[model samples]
Target: MSRSKTDKPSALVATRPDPFRAAFQQTVELLIQRRADLLSETAINAYVDCDWLTWRGGSLKLTTTGENICAQLRNKARLHARA
Candidate 1:
């Protein structure tokens, strides 16, 4: 059937934010702030899979790569806000 001009888009067809990116950012923030206890399973897995996080002794820690990524994320966020 032909659609009408005023018809609203279906909710199922709506674009959503990337879940992985959201989780990754949350993970990075928590790790950088030393709040690992607040991290979710998805966040931990995403960071570990990207090699941005690591286990040190009995605690979760950010690798050097993780630190660099966090810095980049911060810079990007700042730029986006300015825009």
Candidate 2:
């Protein structure tokens, strides 16, 4: 009689982080401390890597997508405040 054989998974997918998460969080923290109408490029750059951050004009402004990202951070802060 032949016996059925099953092989376990050989290799798992290797995944690495963006390597910018820490910088992103740092930028968010600084912004939270400022709690101002807008954050400056210098400040954001000081914390987060400029590679991902982008802006224009003397007054640095977040891009359309950045706004969404900031909004999410704000929401998280609000949720945390209640806790």
Candidate 3:
């Protein structure tokens, strides 16, 4: 019922971000940047599953949600770079 002195405060125990997810998002960002070499059948399917991409005229296209996500990623990158 009481907090232990050995226990770390939640604020001090920051969770590290997942590198794989970050890498995947960077891949998606590349796709948005028209890096055709990065988009494969499996990658397309994965993006589609997340509703961040769609098939349009037999070509992969970003959905509205995808655009928003890409924008957020770009902003975050910019902020991180500034920092």
Q: In model 2, how large is the Cα lDDT of residue 49?
A: 32
Q: What ranking emerges by TM-score with the best candidate at the front?
A: 1, 3, 2
Top lDDT model: 1
- Which digits, one per residue and each the tens of the lDDT, describe model 3 over residues 1-83? 88565443322222323452355576766766878576676766655665667779876777786676667667888999999
Query: lDDT of each structure?
Result: 0.65, 0.45, 0.62
lDDT of 3: 0.62
lDDT of 2 at 32: 51
The TM-scores, one per candidate, come to 0.59, 0.36, 0.58
Candidate 2 residues 19-79, lDDT tens each?
3333455565554575424555554663223323444544334455445555766687799
Q: Model 1: per-residue lDDT, tens digit, 1-83?
A: 88664333222112323464445677766777888889887767656655667788977887776676667667878999999
Please report how far candidate 2 places residue 16 from its true position, in Å: 10
